[model samples]
Target chain A: MNDPVAFVSAMKAIGAGLAMVSAIGAGIGVGIAALGGVQAMGRNPDAAPLIQTNMILGMAFAEAVAIYALAVALIIIFAA
Target chain B: MSEVETKKRRFGFKRWIVLALIALGVYTAFLGPTIFRPISPVVVLPPEGTGLEIFGFPITNTILGTLIADLVVILLGLSAYRFHKSGQIVPSGVYNFFEVIVQFLWNTVEGAAGNKWGKRIFPVVATIFLLIFVANLSKLIPGYESFGQIKELHHGVGYAPVKLFTIGSLNVYTIDKGQPVEAGHADEEHAASDDKSAAYSVAAYAEGGDELCHSCEVVPFLRGAATDLNFPLALAISTVFLVQVFGVWALGPAYFEKFFQIRALVRGGILGSVNFVVGLLELILEFAKVLSFSFRLFGNIFAGTLLLSILGALTAVLIPVGLYFFEIFFGIIQAYVFFLLATMFISIALVSHHAEEHH
Candidate 1:
């Protein structure tokens, strides 16, 4: 039960799983942005394309945070 | 209206038959056998192009992909040159397509750099965008990830290649004549002792059995170049290096002052100390940008390919198609993001501190 190799592997797997938890934050953030965009669109429809471009750009920035977490998870699994 | 409706109705039966045949053909060719007995798609984080040796130099599948990308760039360049030499004022066909893309890229650089630095920086930004875009989309080609040299592994011997081919294979004459070959039995004994898995060392295919082990394999070709860490890392390093050079060219010794802040450290006031520390942090962040840039592109593309292969394995029907389209969209977006980030970074470096403060 206390074997070192097995313990290390388990820890790595746990760390990777934990890293993925960041996606929840990113998901919520992007969802809120989209909701705001939808509400704004309802108020004024002429700014649709402008709103969409900004929304996508913002979502990409948000997604990059998640991607960074993924990179960390990958490093733990592969590099370690 | 009646005539048009009659004409449309006339081809309906034939069109449906053709569509059905195509659907059936696609099913059998790609996903039919895998449905009955699913195959686990090989998904490794790091690029492991089949370990092919050529004149003792290791050649990876990513290198092959990069070579193909270079060929494409060359072809595009050659045609553009030909079009220029032809002196055609009005372009058509492929040249027109090239003109539109180049014009769009130029507009982007011009937007970022204004009229001044756009011409100077246009080549690098446009080339990176084109290269990455093509490399990303290349994965969408049919049999892109599927076709490759498959390797068979031995269980106990632990990755003993049963059958393999490389550029070295073509130089069999040199290998035979240049070096004295050792005894087979002696070599086998040496290898077995090195691995030390004698208990499980039953020759899985000793009796001239099938060369390929069903499960243990490696594909040596057609992986997207951007999915490999080396390509993106190299690109990031070059971009960061060039950005710094551009900063120096634009601002001369003043650019170095932003990074070093020797004057701030010497002054030793509270603001000066803070500014100096921030300068150091900025220097560190510059290096960090390379890490973020390389990993972002590599991780996204690699994960995308893995997602696709997994999807194909898990389903026989329409689910994978949706993901395929998603990947296509993502490839374009990533290229655009990389382009924008690069241009922004360069432009940031080129702009002076006073100019920023004024704005």
Candidate 2:
């Protein structure tokens, strides 16, 4: 922390690492969504296409949080 | 009055066995040794394209890639038009494929933009989708980026040798009679052996002490267009600009009211002030949409390119095939998202406040 350049570099690295922690949340969220989708599919096979589309859309949105985290990490590493 | 519960579907025993076999196969594939030596893949920003200068303007590999995509699109369009004009009722080959794509895109846009505006915006949205889709998928073609010209390094030009996939020392070159000459020729009994001022140049791309005297660098001729920020930014700006123009054409002078809210301020009350501020905020949000739109597509596509290049550098074998498939899917989804977002913006603009209240 005494050296400004070193401190900033360390902090940036820490920030990038912290940003990736959101991936854990995103993973859990997607897994829960997929579980629900699977249960729905099991219960109503006829509504498979509609359910699958919605499920994938939801998963994409959820995964977007992870992508955001990755973008942040990239910016921190490169832009910093 | 009753919940008519459908019976739960279960996978058959044969299906379970197939799934298990596939899982095992994938696991074993991962367990196998890597095809190439493990190296920390370097990720560079603002992707380095071959700086090919044409009349003082440097054209990038990404631009070349875009040009290739545009050419492909145009050629296909011309062929499709010919096929249509021939009036073959039993559509086959390119005609059938073109019809299917166009019909699908039209239906999708029509659903989102409604029947009236859909016809107006279909060309713009479909063109963007097709161009991006082709550009994205074009990267997967073999030798699309891997083949290029090898440039020889000259002395006094600050060329730092970076690591390449190959493992060999570069051949050293020396100035012989004012020309770069390879040093290994013992048969040349030139009297220059006594000259200490002769400059020796060597190029090597790794951190090994065994450096080659003369090194050449490969400049890839093609790169994914979306991997560059310029393409996405230009697309986003044009899309948003077009949306605004369409809005003005549709709503006339009333369209500016969404941003300025002069009418709201003139009819002043506490709510009118809030509305005016909200209008300003909404205007700023529109610009933010441009940034978000460009960055989202640019980030996803660039990241995919980075991933593929890194994977390709790491292993020369079967590992990257799965990645290629995933990238293809991701590219298609991004194109769809971009198309949908543009349509949504236009539709949102088309729906004025007065029109909604009249309903």
Candidate 3:
């Protein structure tokens, strides 16, 4: 038969790319979150630091979703 | 007003000003760790471990890093002390730098421990924090995680090989050049020394890779400390035991009455069987304290380390930089949580039994 290695490698590439699609949610979510935080900072400059700290915390929490997605994708691509 | 009252007012006013300054310091630290709190790595191990070691243990760059970091911090502290004597105006530069860390850790420990006991634990917690925090943050530096090797080792070399698992623990032979070239060892000199051939055949972790981080590839470092699971587990066991120890210390032999509910039995006399049973349940819960302390710290930090690895495998860009902020927050929280719970455990141990003490 033709090289199965070529086929498996192609599947992983596709899977890795697809797995990274999970970042879209994170990207959109983080962008919107940043916009919200920036707006709040504009309204209250004093509150900006606390708000930003919380924002990063929120973003980290949100980023965990992307991490979860990446993990799923990684398991697909890397694991036998 | 009396002289004492006037003096008290002055002191209180100064205290408030100091508090504001501290508030500013903390705010800056949270928003911008770069300005104030950047940690560096330490190298512990030396270079002579042949591609494969004559001894059973594996030696790597992290070992070297840990030792160097320890040496620098300890030596720097000693040097700072000698340079700045008892109450000249103030110390500057690295002396000032260390003074700030001392202050930060002092507050962190005291905040967690409360005034009395906090002072005692401050040095231990603060030292560990300074060391680990510096070590952790240093991982961000260009060469910190990048010094490790990527070698394809001969998996099964004959002599005295274990029979069981084919995959050796030292599967990836990292010629770990863990330390930066010392002041004494010039770069050219290092390169020249075939004698101290630090096998630093390192691998570059590209943007977006695999399960673990290329830098921290969860395989295991040569120098594992109490921060490791075994250490943490021992900490957990001791802490939980310490809780009981302190509890007994605070309450005396009667503290066991907490477990037995002899007080409740005495009050209820014949009809206290249900309450007695409930007391036994509380005893069981105390045992779970060990599990809580161990797993909570291990899980969070271990996961934090894992997450960073994955992040490295992903985009090596502005994104991972953001996660550095997240890791700082996560690191502080985990450290504080460990300290706080330990404090609470100790507090529980230390607290005097109101009813019995009065009686």
TM-score of chain A of each: 0.89, 0.86, 0.86
Residue B131 lDDT (model 2): 84
User: Candidate 2 regions off by >4 Å?
Assistant: A1-10, A19-73, B1-41, B149-218, B357-359
Give the per-residue lDDT digits (tens) of candidate 3, residues B62-127: 444455556657866785677665655677777787887677656644654578877655554555
* Least accurate 10 contiguous residues by lDDT in model 2 chain B: B171-180
DockQ of all candidate complexes: 0.44, 0.15, 0.05
User: Which candidate would rank higher by DockQ, 1 or 3?
Assistant: 1
Residues A1-80, model 2: lDDT tens digits: 67998888898999999998998998998898899999999999998755765676666567667766877887898786
lDDT of each: 0.71, 0.70, 0.53
Give the per-residue lDDT of model 2 (tens digit) for B94-165: 767767878887877787678988998888888888888889889778777655544443322212233344
Clashes of each: 0, 7, 20
Model 2 misses residue B72 by how many Å? 1.4
Q: Which scores higher on TM-score, 1 or 2?
A: 1
Over 4 Å off, model 1 = A1-7, A27-61, B1-38, B49-55, B153-211, B266-268
TM-scores for all candidates?
Answer: 0.77, 0.69, 0.47
Question: Comparing candidate 1 with candidate 2, which one achieves the higher DockQ?
Answer: 1
What residue pairs clash in candidate 1, if any at all?
none
Which regions of candidate 3 are displaced past 4 Å?
A: A1-80, B1-91, B95-97, B104-115, B121-132, B139-146, B149-227, B266-282, B354-359
- Indicate which candidate wins on lDDT: 1
